[model samples]
Target: MDEQQLSAAQLAEAGLDDWRQILGRLKARFRTGDPATGFALANAIGQAAAAANHYPDLTLTGADVVVTVSSPDGPGITRRDADLAGEISRLAARLGATPDAGGLTQLELGLDTAAGTRLGPYYAALLGGEVTDGEPVDRSGQVPTVWWQDPSEDNDGPALPAQPFEQRWHFDVWVGHDEGERRLSAVLNAGGRLVSDAAAPAYWVVEDADGNRSCICTPTGR
Candidate 1:
């Protein structure tokens, strides 16, 4: 059966019961209390992934094992991710691991241009990332994935007004929506200004003193 992608509302509801939704992935940190126990929990997760044929990004620290699952080829969480997350949570429970909801942040790179096809190759080479069918992605997952955006068409009338030119590149810093205010406060304290909050609960554009821009983003739905 083809796995259906969950809407933001569904994803939020499903993940809140256990995992936390951040950007395109579902993340949950399991406190193992020790490295040995953490490794064991990692092994169990690996086995579960093997059985499901779905793997998550795993980071094992001193006493915490962070697990992040997402669709391999899509924009956001899919049914496979949600199902695998449940299984991992079950495994963590059996191993006496406690969930820590606030251990990680996901980042994505956005490049605005109408000539993405021409520009993407240069960025791919610069970042040492791969360009798959004209889309640049960090296959190693070490850095944030880059997505190119073109101006949207104005469908309100026959005349399509051109979008004003802006900075070409910005980082999408994904945090839980509830954590956005706290992070935004930190940014402002560091001399950043909020450029726009018109899209709250999804993203807020902020700029530094020099006019460089980035966004604080959450999943689209509250």
Candidate 2:
């Protein structure tokens, strides 16, 4: 086992039923009855993070407090995050908070660029995001994360050179397996083109009329 990172199976064993691990982060939502309660929980979470020396992407709005934890230098959840999550869960229990499992959704940008090392900083600066491991992410948990991909070896084959963002940057809409098809049809109805379904039930490559791409993905049946 890596000393810095914890695998998905280990995260599960750490009693993190309230949290969901996806896209190299462990995300969980705590539902409060009111805004005041929400803010209180968020504050407590901040204190907990400080104590653990591991901060989460904590967001509080209306009646929900969303927390995302991960190691800055490791893949997915780490031992530090799992321990912090345990602390947060205990604090949440004391505050009468309940888990909001369905409130989580993650977005990632797939940019086909050979010069990922060069373009990453530009997009990170442009989007007010931070670059980590050559990927740009919204560390505040407010915006979709952007990651670069080499289109030279994708299932879609070689990518074409483009004048602008079209055909290069696309979205990866992470959804539950149960909701994948519904979302796919909705996008198609919204005038998005089906680029490829060769990897269906796992991911479906989609494109807009202008050639921008997005994939509808599910967690199961992969």
Backbone clashes, each candidate? 0, 0
Candidate 2 lDDT tens digits, 20-128: 7666677788998799888888889989988877778877889888888887776666777888888898888899989876547678777888788788888888888
Superposed by TM-score, candidate 2 places the C-alpha of residue 61 at a distance from the truth, in angstroms, of: 0.5
Candidate 2 stretches with Cα past 4 Å from truth are: 1-4, 129-138, 154-166, 175-202, 206-212, 218-222
- Write down the TM-score of every candidate: 0.79, 0.73
Estimate candidate 1's RMSD in Å: 4.4
Cα distance off (Å), candidate 2, residue 172: 1.0
What's the C-alpha lDDT at position 29 in model 1? 85
* Candidate 1 residue lDDT tens string, 1-222: 236778877766664455877766788888899998899999999999999899898989999998889877865778788889988888888989998775457888887777888987888888888798787777777777788767563422123223344677888888865677777889999999888777676777788887778888876544
TM-score of candidate 2 to 2 decimals: 0.73
